[model samples]
Target: MMFDNKKVDSGTIGYFDTQQENHFFDRKSARIAVAKLSQSISAFANADGGELLIGVEDDKTWRGFASVEDANPLLDTAFDRLKSGYFDAEFLNSDHFPGFVLHLSIERSPSVVYSTSDEAYIRNNAQNKKVTGERLDSLRRSKGDITYESHAIPASLEDLTNSETMIHFMLESDRISEPSEFLRKQGLLIDGNPTVAALLLYSDHPQGQLPHAGIKIYRYETSGEARRDFLSGVPLTIEGPIYTLIRRAEETAQKIIDSIPRLDQGSGLTKIEYPVETLHEILTNAVLHRDYGTRDYVHIKIFDNRIEVESPGRLPANITPQNILDERFARNPLIQRGINRFPDPPNMDIGEGLNTAFQAMERLRLNLPYINESGDHVRVTIPHEPLASPQEAIVNYVRESGRINNSTARTVTKIEQERTIRRYFAELVDAGELAQRGSGRGTYYEIP
Candidate 1:
């Protein structure tokens, strides 16, 4: 294969023959194993990306070919035919074996895979079968021909506020062009009236109309306490527009950030120890993907050392935590499109956001983002203490202050303006280093 390392010992190369539940090869040479190939390719692309090694014996043995010259022509023909198909496929040939080994790599793309016959198929374990009628129905129900944005709610367009929508559009002008036209194109308006998506994105009081479109934020000193508080105590709910909901969530997150105690350093320049992009990515994902079908609103919980964003409903069919990164299944396509219009559209590339969140945390030495499924809810948890050797100065500042603002962080730490202090503060709070207070310009930092 093109990836074969001659220096790699035989044992490593031989490992390719071991078939996992998701990989397969042709039992007979030259004849295409349609089902086996489809199942392996789809499964690996759906799950974490994996390799499919071909031309290796079923018994995990590599036999030297009778003639390399003869086999070369056959391999070339097979690969050429496979490439012409709809699904994206790559071919590799290895000479390390006495004859040659073929390696096929499949990458997940936005486009769904269908057989050359144009039939959608899914792999169950080792079986390659057409998608069931029930599965197709589920897919239709999830999004349908009309997206969430275009769906007309029972309410009138007059119920939506244009000024609010225009303000938000202006705020995100850098990300979109021709805001009014963009809104119309996204089905945010109907006959000069605002659609539900438009109302959610632009209205100041969207909850008054939909009643179920707001977010609930809760804070507790401990995880158990936070759970108990939500279960029995007064849940702090923030009901308003989607933009307001996002702002409130960020504010609440900042408060949680300020609770972490920072260690005092004589120098004013405080090193921010938390990964901000990861926090923003998680929050943005929750807002964009949350299920709007249910009356239950999205819930956010802050604990002494962690923050959890609980979105309504289970992941769309065919999507799981393991496959979420590779799969580009979106429950709210219209919502996704609208959000993407924002200047900083939260990660849109297939399987990049979650992976980026994980990688960023790893690089910052912060705890990896945690994903949990409970019935219809998907909760993503980002902890603060992903890294050791905490910055004492930052910790002390958070411990003493109730909250911190971007200006304070910039003045205290002297970080660049473009760098997000909110994210850093939120990570610190999640790690039990600081807390946040206030909002907008009044926002300030304090020790947790």
Candidate 2:
């Protein structure tokens, strides 16, 4: 069969595509390319599908190969691998290279493609990497058209809290057309037995079944050191029903927000400089997407100027920072759905929470949210800035008066007189140009 050279376009050079100086070619070795091909296929399937042209150059250079006679045998071997049921592969058309080139097209079905060993891979940017370890585990548990969300949990009926589970079932039931039947079809509860995911979401004491499921909130008074004190704050540990846990987390977050002094905007408006919705979205996301399989719980660290919410798990399969907003791979579908049933659940649609937080920050004209992933944990830091512009007033006060109290600073910056001068004090303190006097009400801030 003859192949049409016009069909292929220039792409990057990697395991999946071979460079011919000018054009690119798909790797010819069935055994050698199968692994990378599987990853490319999986990534495309996981994301918006795209074409994978072989025998092309990274810089759009194309050097035509011999002919179909030279590439057909390799193509046959590759097709056999797909037919074996170890992976999902499709044959598009070879018209592109009628005689001189070979073209193959693969599509992703709702079914996940696995290797002979049942291992999966996802493409990262231009590279195909194995989706293993925690990342893979999280992906396997994700909710998607062909994912395993419909599967039942392994435990017995006694493992679940029926009353609590029914409440969630009822709430979700009202939204869908057929609640009970849908629950049965989704394998949420079989023969009145809760699936592992169901138990985690609705059980009064989900931790009894999945002890690792919980949220850890910590407050630290930094002494300008890396590791410092347990200090004057409390560490709130919450577990049990997903609904209760979310509520507790939100309440805990609010308490931490309350602890930080509010800006004294002289105006009647009580606007927080940092978007409260942004904080809610980040914290809610941490709880929803966290990997419950790991013993580590979600952690919230309240520092002087910023709050960091660290969830236990890394990015889901085939997900990265660039495409995080465009695509969403929920680590816990059951938990996600359960949270949504709450009076105010988080927005997980297409990973919009992160984007919402970002937009909110941009609206407030504050710094961007800080995201860090280490090992199996993802930490998001949101800093609190002054709601009203205080730099000029702060500089004037410091330069003229030489010092000012928390109250005096706000007085000088009349822009928004109600906001406590604490924000200005914190900025100055962070800059190493301010010091505090006395304690409590007697405490006053002055330029040092």
Candidate 3:
């Protein structure tokens, strides 16, 4: 299939409401429960957002609203139960296709909002779950409305020290000496009290205060099957200031990558692999953007096929995984700003880290890393291979470059999973005007 930039999936438009989804289909299933309807609106606003189809049913029936005017009073009643400044009437409209139904598109809010009944709701797996306590705080942090890094911690400037990391940061960023003055100048210290960012950056022992602050690495010998010993061994913990944590994780991950061997499918040869730059950027981003308030450590897992780095937070604000590469919203601005001062920092390019990682993967003919936001954790997976199958990479490579070979084919395609590239080669030979040359591993394919 030819992928393009068109937002509307014409083929799947007819498939909406066949089953339950993030979108709610009202269809006058019952009277609009004002309190209940308000929950949906608040949930959508707090979470990643969703649509409210007023005249659609769960079984794919388009039951028209008794008249759009009839639902106005009901919608208003529901709106009254929602917190002020959260929803807008501009989102409500009628469409002809779904039986002249009303559509309410809720954009994810940047702030934490609640219902007038003093309850906050978040959309989770096509349902609205009420949020309270730490979960609500987590939601607020996810939306970038509040950052835990700037919060005051029970520490003084003495708790912080002039470590080698601090010295490096001072020289690299060309800042003035006197760590106390620098901390005060950067708002990391207020009234002689140290902020979370201050201790994490300049302290010799940040974990002494914030026990949750650190990195954990595990080399899982996963058999890729259902087993009890999935992790396979003991884990390694990386401690110290946040910069040190990032570096430790980077070194461990690089060590794993360098020691491994990758098989080339087309050539049937094994070669010593190299560390992907994507891991460095991702690990740095995880540390910089993680939720520091929670008692969770950054976890890095190295497997046979992929590496998973999980941070203790969701994507901040309106930055979803879908728009993460194109959007910019810093969860911890102080950390981001201060970390840039560190010598040989992993994130030299600030906002371009993820996008750069993806481009670098493509340049090396490997599969782009998969990024996902699962509940309270944001996990990024960097695979040690190419995109799935010989068909996709081989067809595209041969189509664009106009030829392919056993050596160049594996290099470009990264097709290491399969025993042979013959299936895709035969496919192209039968469909496209492809011809084979030579014999065995020395053989190549051409289009003439």
Candidate 4:
């Protein structure tokens, strides 16, 4: 799919030698067997897409092919393993190098890509891990190519037709069709049985059948690792139809957040709180977009300094934490549609929920939410800490302590790089706000 070739400079060649191989990049020699080359392409496609340089040696040497004809086998193997639109291949050439370097770019496919031998491989860190059994099924579900929600569940027709939730939903949405007809129209009924989406939306006690499809909230008094001694009370469990579940969970969480008090430098004491919109959007996203196939409830852990919302399932398709704000993929389309039909839907803006949550934090001068993926769940940690400029933090610390060192300043400003903090200190000194006293490790800055 790539039309133009990339011209490599001397600097680019040097970078290729020094750069380490990780999740997104790999280097292979032109002499690699055709079968091994196929596995690398499959691994990249199965996970997030990565780049493979075929002419690079294991020792970080530039040993390219003699001519275009010499690289044909590698190119042919890549194209045969991946579909047309799922990959791009381009040759890299430099006047400073001996021969051409084949560059193959692979993209995350909507479905799993198998090797020429008809075996599956997934990319983990820098290795190509073979997947089989349940993990393989999970890989397909996570990609959104197939969903467990579409599977049918055994239930009487009256269970859905006579339910109060279904009746109320139909009337509010202004649909005249009978309940059975509506379920059929929406693809929630299959082979005379209701699907998972139908049961979760209409059943008064969905947990009777799906016990883990709910929310569990815990309040921990400590900022460190959670322990039983730190737990304030018995964990509260909220279970009901999907609509009611979202509302009750949010209300309960807000009350707990309000009761916790924090000390403010200016206000003396105030209740710990986050933006209401942030809680609503994040909670709704966790419930609606989570993987119902996984047997676990969404978790809300309210720590003293932050709140953690853990939702089951990994990111679907090519969506990652880095690009979540710009990309959108729905694992449970039916659940999303059903919930959006409520009078005042929780997801009012749909795809912009996380974006809205982030902007609210910025508006209040608070730290933005941090997202992390672990095992089968994705967690979003919203810190109650405020955001202050590095220069402001340094000056304020010096005023209170009479002297500020590099280590203390880094902690105060939440900065990691020593050079960046030094730059800020230098700027403050040039402005006549502080004076440097010592050098190196013992360096300290105080009022002039």
Candidate 5:
């Protein structure tokens, strides 16, 4: 079987059985055991999603049920029984070739999922670890960092900002231009005291109040492969009010990007690797979405082939790597909203920044940025090269989607130059893989 829906290798056996994140198999058991299956299901959902192979053995050999038609019902029966109980199981799909492996893909739940025994378990490597006491509370808090941002700081208006900056914030939020009243209405100032958001936004040096609320940038002469910290020209730190920090950090990062060695975009020509808009959007997101509660500054490491911007805190709320494009959540709503009123604001559109950055990179035929999340931080990596050959990828896209335009082709192939799009389309047409259709301005291509 193969996950043709995604870009993965074609395999004939139970997929993800050996790989640990989500795959589980019970080979010794011939019948569908509800208790055992539900435990695995709950663990996978509570952590990251995974697959279950009912008949596969420890050695990766297939046994028992011969077809998906045969395995799905038995699995469904276990879920149906649990439906009216304390814990439940939801099986997405089961695919098998009768003599081969039965594969089931499980969806990870936003909240903690429990088994029939009412025990919530999270995955710790290959085993299911039960959550209790402080771990449970910590897991809930980690799910959404919004609670931390809502806390009012121990500072008063005098500690937060001067009257001028307060008046500016009031004006941007469309409130009566008074400091205390407007801030109180926005929940930023409480009885003449300021919230953490207000303190971070208005303070002369936010790092003085919040130790980790800054950015640390490094320029390495060698690529990250070298892992040579000494090779870096002394690190630079950008700290101040959120507004000032963004400006200084962006200017400094841009200078480093501008002066870096040009990269050959696999087309034999060396050019500046990343688009300015792409860099701006990424840098803005790193600053705004960071967790100010932690004592870790956002770290930006620039290398020859790639640039990595690692922001403090995990992804806020239910936003995951798979659902980031569609799900929107604000960890610091007050600060994010306040920053947008600055002249030529870096965070022009809050939710659309990432999508816009992706499109901008696609225009240049550069590899789109990727997100990596750990327990404490989310890191974004933007590289100079495309994930695949743009010309080849565009052709495959046209073949699959039926037709495409010059503009869409540019985005799909990461070809920023319009002439390049035309040339690539011409090449596909000449090879009889696609045929040009419609007239000028209404031009498109379809698989021939």
Candidate 6:
């Protein structure tokens, strides 16, 4: 079965020729057994989801099926073995191909997917790893694919019902049901024990149950690496229920950020400004989406030039740094929903927190925040670096120092070329932002 009569360059097949099997892409011969193909389907759906080309061999050769009828066995297993809507299948052929290439694009399932033999698998790098025991449970917990938030804990129902937080929430929501009944209806209380979500939402000290559930904020004096010598004061621990914890952490961090000063044009030294929305969203996400399984609190480190928020988990589910703004997964759905019920909730827009933060940073002309997934953690760095142009930098430098020469402009803007600095000065002068004072070796520019 050929793709179409339409002709395309043989080089177009390079997509398969140069494609190496990785976490997101894999190729297999069409003669592979049904069970093995099922494993690949289960793996891609379990991990971040990926593309699988079933008609290609390990050595980058396109060994497609002889005909559409011959591909039915594999197609049936791919579709029938998994739940509907998990993947899409298409056949491809070019002027250079001898058979039809079966392409399957799988999505990361919200629930774990099992193969035909009921074995669960997850894709890791280039291999389909059969997951069991702790690894399987860890997979379920990541991105709230399974409902870990509703898992029962040792805390009593009274721990949630008697809390002042719950009481206020009930009153504000205008609910007349008893606190225990209300919590039970919300799936927060099971049997006689409070669930994880109930404890985090209503208990006075959720940290009492989950010791590492709160946040720790630190300030470093240096703009470089964080070391013992650069540490400012003692780290501040923000502990409470999830709602209070988020607010306290945000306010405290903002206060420290506000105290930092920067040189501005004509304003002299002014309070350094980073979009408040950016801090709020990132901080809120760091708390709500972090992995509770890890025995560490969310760490917020403030440096001279940036703020770093390290959450105690990798980006959940199919989420990667590149697609964080576009993907939505709640590691703790109940906690997220409960907080949204608060008066003027911390997360005003569900699933749009990071998107809001990115937009806010762009509006301020600041570089977008950097997100990286470390081993057991995800770190987001909010840099204070501006997107000002070279001419603007020169004008600002002259305004702050009363004068800027070629050497000084080069040093301030970090543009190593003296000619580039001179061009910037010329543009600033043409724009009337700076006035040339003299020529020859004594040349200097000052703000007009």
For all predictions, the C-alpha RMSD in Å is: 13.2, 13.6, 8.1, 8.3, 7.5, 9.1
Which is the leading candidate under lDDT? Answer: 4
The number of residue pairs in model 2 that clash at the backbone is 41
Report the lDDT tens digits of candidate 3 across residue range 1-448.
1111122243434655554574442233324565666777778888776677555556655555464565565467545643444444422222433223455556677676676576889887778889988888888888787889988887756647466666666777787668778888889886788999988987877888898899888876644357333674578888888777788778887786565566677866465452467888888889999999878999998776778899998888768888999999998999888777787666789999988888788767677888898878999988877554556667677778877886676666655533466766777788865788878877778875
lDDT of each: 0.57, 0.59, 0.72, 0.87, 0.68, 0.83
C-alpha lDDT of residue 116 in model 3: 58
Over 176-197, each residue of candidate 5 has an lDDT whose tens digit, in order, gives: 5556555677788656667778
What's the true lDDT of residue 355 in model 2? 84
Which residue pairs in model 3 clash with each other?
none
Q: What shift in Å separates residue 274 of candidate 5 from its native position after superposition?
A: 1.8
Q: Write the per-residue lDDT of candidate 2 for residues 157-205, one digit (tens) a residue.
A: 5435345555565675565544445455656886665666676665677
In model 5, the runs with Cα more than 4 Å from the true position are 1-43, 51-106, 112-121, 130-138, 161-164, 167-177, 189-193, 223-231, 263-273, 386-448
Which pairs of residues have clashing backbones in candidate 6? none
The sequence of per-residue lDDT tens digits that candidate 1 reaches over residues 1-448 is 3323233455666565454545333232323355445544544443233445555565655643354444454444334333333233233334555554445555432234444454545444554556646453332333232244455665555434346655666665753555566666666777776677776776667777678777777766533533442332456777665555676776666755665454446765343344666766777677777766555788877665577888876566456676676777666766666656655555455346677777778776666777876755788888867443334445555556644567666554545553566667778768866656777668666665
| Cα error of candidate 5 at position 30, Å | 11
Residue 19 of model 1 has an lDDT of: 48
Q: What is the lDDT of candidate 4?
A: 0.87
Best TM-score goes to which candidate?
Answer: 4
What are the models' TM-scores?
0.50, 0.53, 0.74, 0.77, 0.68, 0.73
**Residue 191 error, candidate 3, Å:** 3.7
Measured with C-alpha atoms, the lDDT of residue 358 in candidate 3 is 85
Span of 10 residues, lowest total lDDT, candidate 2: 21-30
The number of clashing residue pairs in each candidate reads: 47, 41, 0, 0, 4, 0
The true-structure Cα RMSD of candidate 3 reads: 8.1
